[model samples]
Target: MSKRRKRKPKHFRGVYALLVFPFAEDFHLLLDLMRRFSAAVRYAYNRLLEGKGREELKRQDDLLCTFFRLNTRHADDAVLKAQAVLDSARERGEDPRKVVFGGRKLFETLRRRHLSGKPLKELKREWKEKRQGLLYSRGDRTKGGNLNLRLEAEDGALWLRVNLGNGRYAWALVKTSHPNLSALVERVHASLPYNVELSLKDGKVHATFTWEEEPTPLAATKENGVLGIDVNSDPYHLALAVVGPDGNLKRHLTLSLEEVDRAPNRGTKELLLWKIAHQVVSLAEEHGVAVATERLKHLPKGRRGDGSGRAFRRKQHRFAYASLLRKVHSLARKKGVQVVEVNPQDTSAIGMLKYAPLLSLSKDVAAAYVIGRRALGFKEKLPKGYGKLLRDERFRDHAQGFYASRVRELQAKRAQEQNPYLRRRLSREIGEAKRHLSLLSSLQGSPGSQREVTDGRNSPGVNPWRVLRVGTFLPLLGREVPRDLSPLKVFLHRGAWEGWRESRGPHPGGGPKRANVHFG
Candidate 1:
């Protein structure tokens, strides 16, 4: 097997809770330890950039212990944190020499504080707290959850035991609104490993507990059936389809995610996503079927000023596919449901051309149907109707003619349009029309059993589905994604070369031409 790609660790996103300490203990002592730990982290970071390894740094951690007044454990964790920061900077393609432990944003804020009418003293205080108010202790399985810091359950409430240097320890009552604190407690009781983090935010101390959770063995299997999920952006809903083992649609439904968009804050929105994830898993468990979803990629949001980049970000900001999918995957694992990720390529087009009209299902639901079938290890063959449409010379000509007219129209407008943005938009349309014309023009010979058409050297291995998608959708139906796909029913059953559609001469653009509403 090839080398596996490194991904984010499978640990849970940790829980942050308020730390309430006893009045008798000196909180400043905790503050002093935090200051030393922060200094060691920065020192180790600089040393790492000079080519020092972790083990080398740890062996001579006496320099950190003596200089920062920290113990061996704190010194070790400081090296770990510094290594993490360096690795992250390299991953993001940044120079490690310019790495700022306190954050560059805080430095910039000092310059902007006068404009915002905020006091310089307060800004400085905030910056200082950010730099020195961090503490971290990694867990050791041999040491029962943690070494320097530990969580002890006492009287139904969780309290943190913090180690101060030279045989001194401090305790703080850990209070959290998060419901998963019990899971942390369970790990602590079982002597399983768990990491601890403490940071001061606005004078209040907070503790974070994190661990990698092992998933339960999958109960639901694809042998029973598959439930495919499609998250649509425009309507802001999740479309689901239940496909039987034989690859036939059993039932389908949609769950609205509009409430997540309307949420007032990030935390609330995350909670809402988790709730939606629960519902999806519950459905899978109820049907005893594995879940299937698109294996989406992380495409970079390009820099602004480029027309395509701006357009990409505008649409991307309005949806939450990855975040929601991660939640779904995490919840499914815990619930003992299997989740199969399928390649999203052509699933949309295949659904639009084949199943939409045949099953009278919506486009999103049809795509879900394709996903379910694919997860069951089924290869999608071209439908007979669509295959026949590709072989029809008249149909291909009509499609090419429509795109030719569109290209001419866009080029005409692009010449006269004064606005650069509008001209750029017109250029994009012109390029799209020319591309469609190219694809349709490339179809030379008759498609065989596989219905594969050689799309020429420029575009190789063009299948019937692609040509059918380009040929039928905009040319026959008059819209890329028509609000009413019922019109495609005729193309599906009767024939793709519609006489009435082709009889109407191609308008300037894809839409119908009308003069004063085509009558007045």
Candidate 2:
């Protein structure tokens, strides 16, 4: 056998170039061309479906050329490509409508032809110099100038420039004949700034452009603690587990969204997201911790039924869930927090207790439960006390130890057993049980400690916050929880901080009469 070598950690630094395709003047022309081409293709396909004669179709194609004011060659090519796609789809037992509206294959072909070309690095440099000249001249009459491009590389940083209109963007495709170049063409056509970066560690490629404003920096991660998060429409809730050396909860911080919604601006949504994400990072920095969240990405939404009403509601529910998951992921990455997605099905409802209740379980747990329920031949009744049991620090330790021993035992049994069928059955059952146990164990232990707690019901000596609700928002703190009294008790007291109006100014009516007042 060949010896396996361990892989080393890798990293890379590169710039993200934003290349704009259609210079302002040419954008409308390009849009017209696309619309004309689409209409032509659809027309031809319909003709074919109606069993039109070949000569008649050829005449129609010619007419399409005249209608779009394109040369016969271009029109012919578009017709052929569209027909080929439709024919291919029909052969594969797919609807032609699905194939036409669905853009993956079409876009893939374009990318292969246009985006894959000579090193974009060289083109980017050229564009930068031209852009500088234009800027220096104060937008002097530079007729037929190149499109503006922005370069955001690690070393050079963020800079913008323009390239002369030599048709190099179009010529690159003609020269390379690589289909991938179509991606570059399409981007340029969109008239948005674009750039690409390469990550050497995993050979991962990242592309960014004027699609949306650059994402804010909100990435965070914890070195030691586990962050339990709950996802909801109103607000995202977070709970941190600060464990002791003995794997007990030493302290925790809970954040909710009430503060976020209180902001007056319409863009409060994005601002709130950034604020909460930054707070999570700050918390992690103060007391090293990792983050955990329930993976509710595919949690079914919508009442069960067969009618269109149910379908429409389900679709809306799916959209909401998807949007929530996206925000969580984006925020998590910006914070550098290790986000572990647990299952949602059982985490919220199972074995949930008062003091360390599983407010939201990770998606992984839900996945495991799905497999477990199937393997155990149960009719899928919700697991009882599974959530609370999983959250128990002691139970988690036991489950981990149990899984390790069970795996070893299974290996030994496999080595001794002769019957393949029995061995296979036993192996599957063991695997399912282990998965379930592992998920439960994760909830039982605090985020960082390796030690196992033997008692499932014992308080981990952690202070529970009285005022903090599951999804309330919190401001950034400069210090870790105070050591004198429990942090939880302090948090409860702090929650009663005076209102903004009382602390900053008198009433709007210019009156200072009220003794005291509180609003929820």
Q: Which candidate tops lDDT?
A: 1
What lDDT score goes with residue 432 in model 2?
53
Give the per-residue lDDT of model 1 (tens digit) for 1-520: 9999998435364677998878555577888899889888998998888898877777644678788878778889999999999999999898989888788988887766554445776678788888999899998999988989988888898888889978898888988978787778788789888889899778888888888776678899899999999998757899999999999999999999889989999999999999999999999999999999998867455445545645456555758889999999988878888889988877887787778888988989998998898889887766666666776777777778777877876798899999887787678778887888887887756333245322111123465677777776677666666545665666566555553365554333343341111100
Tens digit per residue, CA lDDT, model 2, 225-325? 44444444322344444433233345555566555445587566656766676775555445645555555535445453422244445444523334444
TM-score of each candidate? 0.83, 0.34
* Alpha carbon lDDT of each predicted model: 0.79, 0.38
How much lDDT does candidate 2 score? 0.38
Can you give the lDDT of residue 120 in candidate 1? 70
Model 2 misplaced stretches (Cα beyond 4 Å): 1-24, 33-223, 232-247, 259-266, 301-325, 331-335, 354-520
